[model samples]
Target: MTAEEETRTAAPAERLWDLAGRWHGVAVAAGILVLTRVVQILLLVGLDRAIPDPAGLRSNLLIWDGGWFQRVAAGYPQGYTYAQNGALEGNELAFFPLYPMLIRALSAIGFDPGSAALAVSWLASLGAAVALHLLGTSLFKSRRAGWALVGICCGAPMSVVLSMAYSESLFLALVAGMLVAAHRRVWWAAGLLGLGCALTRPTGAAAAVALAVAALVAIREHRDEKKWPPLVAAAVALAGVPAYLGWVGWRVGEVDAWFKIQTAGWGTSFDFGDSTIGFLSDTLTLADGWVPMSVALILLVALAAAGVALAGRPWLPLAVYGIVAMILVYGQAGYYHSKPRLLLPVLLTLLPAAAAAARARPRVAILAISAWAAFGLWYGAYLVAVWPYTI
Candidate 1:
């Protein structure tokens, strides 16, 4: 082709390239998250065929807590037995509202509960990745660091939950969105996202602590403004746990109905890590011959410790969120074996390691991320496929 023709042809491609370059941060993060979800979907598809469940493909992505969410989305149908005398002593109260509500909305439009929940989860995971890209890039001032953070988030062992009909994806999206907004000093937006986060998970109260910390930091740095918005954000976030607990209490006709549900129904409460320590002890002693379980638990604890040690290096809000989230997750007397999955919402816990990986030489970073991705790619499948543990 002539020079003129070549230039003309390249113009269209140039514009496309420019647009893509402008969106590189969000695109990269979303791409990685999507890629992970695709892998998970593929695994689930295979699992569906291998197992002869009537729901088939729909059931693969809606296991465990996903099942509970589906039940809630259906408005506690007549057969749902998690309720006791109008009080929830079962898994129903243990689950939050926002996720089920979203699924419910989609299901109303003719989609099945499981499929709707899975689709929403997939989209939310991508949204979470995009917001995380913004926060990571802004906090660390390095694109590599931002992408690394996304990688860590997507590659964590429990990241498999992101693809399932679970609240982690939606919760993370709102959380990361609020954090990004706070970093940008968009107080109103932060406050709004904080509200959604509040409704998404019980641990969402961490958003309040984090937002309050951010507000205080802003005050210290003389950058405070729109004071009401930050305060509102903090208030809403702080209210989430109590509000849910209060509702549970009212419904169950006991002030501590929620706590009772967690304890009697789910075997979860505040024992200050005693149960965790005991579980670790049992696993390490080979009483169950599940040495790998012990190893996984140890690594998770190490990750939390390492994350805290590294938290001091990140933005103050992130540090507060990570620290408080970890405390809330582990301080409670929840299922010890579910620690890794339960802690999935604490995305900041991966920031320090992610930053380290980003700063390393290119090949080293690739190796680090590749290893993480490898483990996460299969771990969820194994949990669902081979093991009969709580997913």
Candidate 2:
């Protein structure tokens, strides 16, 4: 090659190398995400042999809630959805708009709906891993902790949703980003990311509350200044969930239309943990299947783990977010198996594991995470491939 040509080729490579060097932690986090995804996808493929679906195993990624998201992306209903007998039915409106809107925007660029949905989810998952790494590093001041956080989260049970046509990936990305911004006292970014989280999922309310706590902490520390930025950020975040809910009500001509739809369609409502307790009781005592028993056990372990995390005295904003998110997941009456998926982003439960892994030797950390990824990936794959229920 000519000298000019060699310079051109090497310059791009050099720049890429420089970029990677500057963001090595992020690169590691991304690698962890990719590793977990590969393991999970392979597990799903292996499970396909036992499940035997005409549409193939990959199709399972878009089953259940994915269908709802796709429907919403196609277009939301102009009014309430009702069953043939005139009963209120769960409609596309029950699904959040941010994810579907992203899918639609991607589709407009000429990709098919399924491809677009997956594309949006995968991209958001990447963003999530990066944001999570930043959050961990910012809070703990350790790159190892950041990487551990990414690995634990991506390899978490039901983390397959990160690769699915679901909004959990987007929600996680926004929530993590918001927390990172809040911890860094970047109020503008925090406020916008918090708003995004609120629009993406109902649990965003918990996140907003967490942001408010962070703001209060900041205000107390700077009592003389009376920082308006923190106050404004909290207010902006607090407005998101209510704004979306109100818009839904206005669109459907009933103030409670969204709640009614959720209850009718998914049997989801806050019951002060009554249903969860009942499920745990039955599953522990007389459960017919191992999956139910396992789920029940996970719920208990998660609660205990969160308690331990609190005892460790994590950053206040993160603790608040984790506790409130857990409340929303456990206090609701709904499909019991789905709780783990919702809990995946609850940093509180993951904190104990992540911190332990961070402190361990590299070989030990890798082995522990490998074992965890093996079971978590398999469990998630089994839920979608063979569980025969909407997760």
Candidate 3:
């Protein structure tokens, strides 16, 4: 290893202190997320006082997916239903378990299911921010870039979901933590975190792929990284996705029941963007679909920018992971309206842009964040109080 690489990898007491002090940026990021969510509540509740769906701002976080997760946590006694009213019913088993399990555990302690779910997301989002900061600092070799990455990530227009009862924050925390552990060559932590990720979301497979690739490359480059944990992580990653699917299938009494749950229950399946293109085409002729279309289009532009930024970049693992995740997301055709929310997991795509902003002046970063916050408040309110799409 080069002297500089050795210096970075072998951190002494001063580096540890610096690392601890640098958490100030994480504090700012967390505060920003809290303030953003607060603004969202203010706008949503103030604008639509007569709308009583969610009942109140505190309860609002459990509106859409939160309702599903809470129902799942409630045991989903109804179980899988292929159809209701002669159409796809969206079974509760279609929802993943870790988030709901967390909510259930919290509810066991006297918290309302909705509030518990929201608390999981809120706390997980902050944890994810800290992990993202560490991963960014390691990858970019600049504390400014790390802080900027945190700001940019939480500033994503849909970041309001970070504070809701969604699993995105929890999944992100695991993913970011896995990335940091791998970067630090903490093989055991990486393996265990990868297992945590495997249990969290399907995208965990993408992370496993990226990490394995990095590990293999490190071996080829004679970096002296361990060999076994990567294999174990990959095994967990490969097995974990199937384990949940298989269990759901077995519980439902059909070997292909998991895929059926996605199709017959929720109408979700791979369509290679045909459904997406069709949705976009229909958007021009339909009035009611405009909001979802606008959201998807804006996200498309951002994704395109991210693709451009990541092309030819040096961060192979992150790029591969982000690209693979995006491919899987875009390949799926069902539920076109939720595309933006679906893309939230592949956030490494934003690193190139965030790093550039970090290289700019502090005011530039402030302006970028300010603009996103202004628009995010409106977008977040729309999601909470108005939009019908399940985020």
* Backbone atom clashes (below 3 Å) for every candidate: 1, 0, 1
Give me the candidate number with maximum lDDT.
2
* Candidate 2 lDDT tens digits, 1-391: 6797557535633443343334786788899999898888888878877755534655888888888888899999988878889988888988878999998999999989988999999999999999888877777667777888899889888898998988999999999999988876778899999999999999999999999999999899867544888889999999999998898999999998889889999999999999999999888889769999999989999999999999999999999999899989999999998999999888889888888987999999989988888888999998887788888
Best by TM-score: 2
Runs in model 3 deviating more than 4 A are 1-21, 50-54, 76-79, 82-88, 284-289, 312-314
Q: What would the per-residue lDDT of candidate 3 be over residues 6-123, giving only the tens digit for each residue?
A: 6755663235336534657667656766677677778778755756555567666777788888898998543467443675456787877788889999999999888899889988
| Residue clash pairs of candidate 3 | 90-265
**Judged by TM-score relative to the true structure, which candidate is superior, 1 or 3?**
3
Clashes of 1: 1
Q: Per-residue lDDT tens digits of candidate 1, residues 71-154?
A: 888764322235546754565776778899999999999988888998889889888887777767767666677778888778
- Which is the winner by lDDT between candidate 1 and candidate 2? 2
Could you estimate the TM-score for every candidate?
0.86, 0.93, 0.89
